[model samples]
Target: MEFNSLGVLMIITIIILILFIMMKKIKNNDSDTSKKLFTAFEERMGLTCDVIDLKEEIYGIGLDRSSNTIIYLNFVNGVEQCIGLSEFKGVYVHRVEQNKRSFGKSKEITEFVFIKLLPKSDLAGQISLELFNHKWYPFSMEELELINKWKRIIEENLS
Candidate 1:
């Protein structure tokens, strides 16, 4: 077999081009999936508003302006829960440590955030919702800010 420098360069270029195209396709697919889920949620809730899609977590937050309600859609559990300011008590940031085995002999420690929900009723127990599982949600900082903003809004409305 006879090989030249130009041949090797061409092969590398082709591989890079293929990788670029594949990445683009994956990004588009994610966007499409998020859109479909958002539409279905809006239809089920019978109201439309800006919906924040935590695509990695398979859930979303939809604020119903007319009713002043916060709708939480959990795709994994197939549950739609709504919390009105009247019944909402408070929210806090909760953290948990997760340990995982990595690189055959190394252990990795990871921290995760959960927005704990509390209701005004004493009979109601606290609920902890995990922010994400496997991959880090890109908009996690923004999501946390949104949650805090909603909490303030709820408190104001309650009073």
Candidate 2:
């Protein structure tokens, strides 16, 4: 078979286009599933989320600005939690790290990451929304980024 430069270029472009479309579909599906999970939580609790951030296919966080409510869901663990901003003092990211020694080499590794909502009342314990856990999920900078973003949003709403 004989191939020209233009033909090769066209074939490469088509493959790239197909890959892009497939990625888009996967992203959309993730978003759709996150929305559905959030919606079900809202209905069950009689609340609505005005803003949502889908961190992954199995988890997301949302806020109901009018009600000052924070909603979270983790499908992987079947965990769901909600808290009102008025009841919390502030929100911040909590990360745990430990040094491990392997073959005389030490490296720091993150154990878990959480977005914690500190309540105003001493009687109320901190509400932790797990963003990542080394034992359960692979480590990714994206998870850290998402937790920080939510921390800022929650803090802004608190203030």
Candidate 3:
């Protein structure tokens, strides 16, 4: 009878340990997913992010969780641009491979603002665009439009 009781006790202890381990795994997974989601939002907004300095990780400033999402604030050229993940729904995301024209004479390369990773429409906060010229040309309307579109999406998501 004593042997049976010990076997039952051992089984109960094992079950409890298993349950505890599963719970811990779940908590860790949720946190990892949130981190990845935030990073992707930064990419979508098309933040005027350029790798100014190389380091052990991205973002020199301390990161924080904002009212809505996480923000990795970086100060470049005397301003903070918060970088984080945004969302999209009911749309198909695709990846593609491209090759440039075989000859240098055939293809045109242009330098302009890339806005895919920026927040929509001053939505994150009221931020003014500071002019930074490249290759002797001032900021163009095309770049401004991209920035505006990102701002709009960010505003919509925040609301």
Could you say which candidate leads in TM-score?
A: 2
Compared with the true structure, model 1 gives a TM-score of 0.67
Q: Alpha-carbon error at 131 in model 1, in Å?
A: 1.3
lDDT of each: 0.64, 0.84, 0.42
RMSD of each: 4.8, 3.7, 16.7
lDDT of 2 by residue, 15-39 (tens): 9999999999998997888788889
**lDDT by residue (tens digit), candidate 1, 1-159:** 246778988899999999999999997887677667766877776777553545433766666667666666666666666656566577776656566766776644435666667877899887665554435544356656765765555455552
Give the TM-scores of the predictions, in the order they appear: 0.67, 0.75, 0.33
What residue runs in model 3 are displaced by over 4 Å at the alpha carbon? Answer: 47-159
lDDT of 3 by residue, 1-159 (tens): 999999999999999999999989997775555445445545565433332211112222222324333233222333445534453211111112233577564543344332233334454542323222244344456645544544454444442
lDDT of 3: 0.42
Give the clash count for model 3.
22
Q: Least lDDT summed over 10 consecutive residues: which range in candidate 3?
A: 88-97
Give the best candidate by lDDT: 2
